[model samples]
Target chain A: MLSEPLIERLTETPLFAVGLTLAAYLLGMALFRRLKQPPWLPGILMAALLLAGFLAISGIHYTAYQDGAAWLSVLLGPATVALGMPLYQQLPRIRELWRPLAICLPISASLAAFYAVGIAKLMGASDHVMASLAAKSVTAPIAIGITEQLGGSVALLMGALLITGVAAIAFVSLVARVMKIRDERLIGFALGLNGHALGTVRAFEIGPTAGAFASLGMSLTGIFTALLLPLAWRLLGG
Target chain B: MAALSGFLWLISFWLIGEVVVYFTVLPVSSGVIGMLLLCITLALRGGVPESVACAAQPLIALLAMLIMPGVVGVFFIAGELVGQWTAILVGLVLGTLLSVVTTLWLMQRLMRGHHAE
Candidate 1:
């Protein structure tokens, strides 16, 4: 709503986009805390929605916004490399229950990719969307890496990551209870295995054991998928 | 300086991963390879370096924020994704439920000896 020249000048710079993103993220975090942090509504998801709505309303093109925000994505590489810390930290827990996790992880991770892609394929999602679908079960940082390798849409993968994460919480809570599968370890493992980081946080709320296993689930799933999905894509896609 | 060094450690591993990927043509994420390398290094060392922990933990925690922009790019592709929402949603919801249910069932059966514990 500024003078036309000023508006054009402001919109031309990357800072404008960066500022909006941070502002939205902070606002989302604040509102999330105020609302008591619902599992179905993560702060990042809220931030995403806020940013999307703003872009939609302001008539600002997403490419223009992306030009400025691309700087933030540069940090994703470092953040992904940082996952080693948690994997190392949770290694003991992984060792303790290595048997079940070793058995569950490959199947869970593979099934996650298989169903997501197969269903989306049935739905007639674009080839890009189907490609992105394969990595949603892994945490975002690593998932982004896989998405890039597959030449998939990072946006679609993020959406899938968030939905899978939230759905993991709901199903684990409802189904796990109904079936009398009460072990925090099992609950946490399922959460992380399917939900990634979001489910890991939820598992933490359950207990330390749950938290640790959730960490383990996400970390292992991430590493496994990151290493394997690209190869599988090449084999199958070729 | 310590935090900087920690970042240096992480970046260094990433570079190492890049180098490996460049050579091997492995079709895998270099950062993931780097992550595995670092994890293995930590395992061998039997402890996390303080600086690496300080740097990596916060970065790991803030990863979603860093990747936030790309996620919002969904808007950019709104046209492409316009009619595909139904498929994406159904796949996401069902795939997630199935994956979790499968994990819970498998873990319950495989870890049954510890069930009573």
Candidate 2:
């Protein structure tokens, strides 16, 4: 720990912001690996928790943190683009099984949206909450867009997205183990379809091939949800 | 130069995705659209270019970190979330489990014949 003046000066600089985030993430990664890679102990979640806790304790605003860390978010675009590597590698297999995937993927995507919104409604969630819940399985960007299109609260939508994503990460493996899912591709695809980005990352942990199929699941689900969600919203009376 | 080019390459496709979405009125995000276009490019080129791979690899490795800000933002709304925690949690857990289980079952059952072949 540095002296008070040095610490104060460091916190005021952009380097401090970026350094804090990276350091926390590295620490989380080390802890995750040392802990034998528990799903709930995912590095991203841990890093977020550590940083969020720090911010809360230090009284630093999220906006100030964002200013330094925006570069990381910008990389999400390229990282998403890089997902094509694994998807492309798996193309031959995808083509071979195109028929089943063509049918299965959309059905899964629609069911993901429907079940989420339906459960929320049954549990007496507000219409706005229902709308926000509509695209809960899709990746954040598309989910955020759909939520806005349906006039849902973005803040609440963000909360729901984080919850669904984190929960999917923690529980999807347990579901896979219980179901005896052995095919890495199937496991990855299921996670991607339901888990979104976090699911893809989890799939990467399983193997490169799993990561590939997971991206396929994630990307195709995004496409399907984007195309059908507005009509679905109208039908749901949102 | 390599990283900048890599970033440019990705951003170019992202821009293209945005344009296509605008013209077609698709609900998809620009990033996914860019991903699709890059997939096509890879298919045409016969492999992921080393430059693109190099540029994208670091970002991919650190992918998890990128989502932290959004998760942290959730804290800002902790008050509102507490009210609906039960419903939200139940909907997320049950819905995710049901969806993942059903899809896996369906995929396995549907693809069994293919696997046999």
Candidate 3:
């Protein structure tokens, strides 16, 4: 139970938390660049972790920062809408590969969800946690919704997504090498489908075409996973 | 005009998302659905509004930033998360590896036929 004054203080100025997060992200980006590691490694995850540490050290509760940080969350809607432009620009190529794009997008999304749930269950995760885990590959908001629908915790779903993005960034290139998968577009698409925004950013760095495909993959995965997870859940009796 | 166009584009994208989700039964966001919808529309319509494109660009640039807020929620629940960290970590790593491999394999098969075509 929190005191009234503490609750008010917690909710009062979320901007500070937002600012702290941005600063941490920028610092992490600079450090990752200086170290010549992958940019996504530090960008979001490091920022989140460092901020968490700082708040913990300062004895500021998580609720206090969230009050200020919710503003950043609101931007996700518009940012998602904004992805339309590059997708629009990539229309010609998309048309050229429409059949492949259409077929691969759903199949890849289904496999990603299935593998996540199956493996988690095998490892002995409970049904609800597995439901949240199933949406790990998609973007955050949609994944959160899917988590709720499947009777899982939204916070758990978010945590799972952040970790998934970080891991994809760290190992996707390695996996590509192992599989001998070479096409830039395919690599980008794979990363995006599995990694979400972090993978899409990596794809952009690889090349414009790769970025475009990755964006396409990310968007398609979000849609596909959201639509299919419930049906898959029922079939799995989850 | 920018606001109006942004709103219209948002609606268009949302409709596109709903239609795609409805037809394909894929659970995607309205924005991504909107992006795919816009892609097809541009292909058929053969162009896009310069203003619409212009308006959408900055928004995209701020995407990573946009997601920060939702992620910040983690800070609030850090204690609880720390307790269940192992399951979360395992789920993320294994899920990502599986998805990436699956996506790569599926795309490879899909693209194999494309090269043949």
Candidate 4:
């Protein structure tokens, strides 16, 4: 129903990138529904892949896409703040579990960064690579900011984040089988701590209790990492 | 309308976090600080506002989608990923293994020791 010039002008604005992203997401969701929504196969990742392919084929630049896409990315802040709701809802369990969680949280959260950065360093990567790797275990919204402050490439961190999240599906189940740890709380906590948002989604699929715990785990771990990683980076001179 | 107010509350906390960071120069995400402040506030309130509950449900549910645009940025810098693929794979695999395993094991040991649920 639009004229050719109008269409071209709209394509040059933020609408083009936003519409493309939405379309890709919808398609990814459709495909994900078809596949029964496996933990390893998240719709976001699928949409990202499709969007990338579309950009490449159409000869569109990432910069062009980013100009508009930043608007959507900004919503991540509000979403992060929204996490407070679930954490609030889980108040009863948190009070009950606070003692043990107090002991367990700091250690697990630290190792989440330690392992990623430690291994990436062992692999002979650059300092920026290590910095990017450091925050991969955290959720995207917080992780992006951490990575930026560490002078790492956001794009590279996304790749590492995806790998880490997808690996979490197998990791939790593997823990269950090999470690004989089947308590949904521990399982979901492990999943969210190690996997971030993707793991939280998988946790929700497991049950309401697991979902709440996963939310708790993800939020606390995010806060923990955000509070400390920069200090650690300063101390270690990363 | 309730959902809209909930969103407003979230942004207010987020802005407070940003202001705190601006003054303190904390090298962390304002969103995270915002989340922390929101938690503290909710703890004081003794419950989540219904508006917040409603707004948070859908936002958290669609978090993956909200995060998509940023992840898609990877395509722009795919070049940087060229030589580092091995590091990424090994890092994710072993790192996640160690992380998940140690968390479960330690939490188990602690919880079992105290008989805490």
Whose DockQ is greatest here? 4
TM-score of 1: 0.94
Q: Taking the tens digit of each residue's C-alpha lDDT, what string does model 4 give over A137-156? A: 89888888888889988888
lDDT of 4 by residue, B1-117 (tens): 999999899899999989999999999888888887888899998888899887877877777777787788877776766788788779878999999888889988988976843
In Å, candidate 1's interface RMSD is 1.4
Q: For residues A94-204, could you state the per-residue lDDT of candidate 3 as single tens digits?
A: 788899889888877887777777777776676767777888888775676577668877766777777787788767788889989889989888878888877888888
- Between candidates 3 and 4, the lDDT winner: 4
State how far residue B9 of model 2 sits from its true place (Å): 0.6
lDDT of 2 by residue, A1-238 (tens): 3455665666676787778778888887888788887766566667778888888877677777777677566666666666666667778878877987998998999998888878887888878778877888887766665677788766566667666777777666787788787899888888888888878888998898788888888877876887688877777667
Stretches of candidate 3 off by over 4 Å are: A1-11, A234-237, B1-45, B75-85
Q: Superposing all C-alpha atoms, what RMSD in Å does each candidate have to the true structure?
A: 1.9, 3.4, 4.1, 2.5
Is candidate 1 or 4 superior in DockQ?
4
Candidate 1 residue-wise lDDT, B23-78, digit = tens: 99887787888888998999999998988987887887777788788878876676
Weakest 10 consecutive residues, lDDT, candidate 4 chain A? A1-10
The residue pairs in collision within model 4 are none
lDDT accuracy of residue B69 in candidate 2: 66
Which prediction has more favorable lDDT, 1 or 4? 1
Every model's TM-score: 0.94, 0.85, 0.82, 0.94
Number of the predicted model whose lDDT against the real structure is largest: 1
Interface C-alpha root-mean-square deviation, candidates in order:
1.4, 2.4, 3.0, 1.3
Q: Individual DockQ of the candidates?
A: 0.75, 0.60, 0.49, 0.77
lDDT of 3 at A144: 65
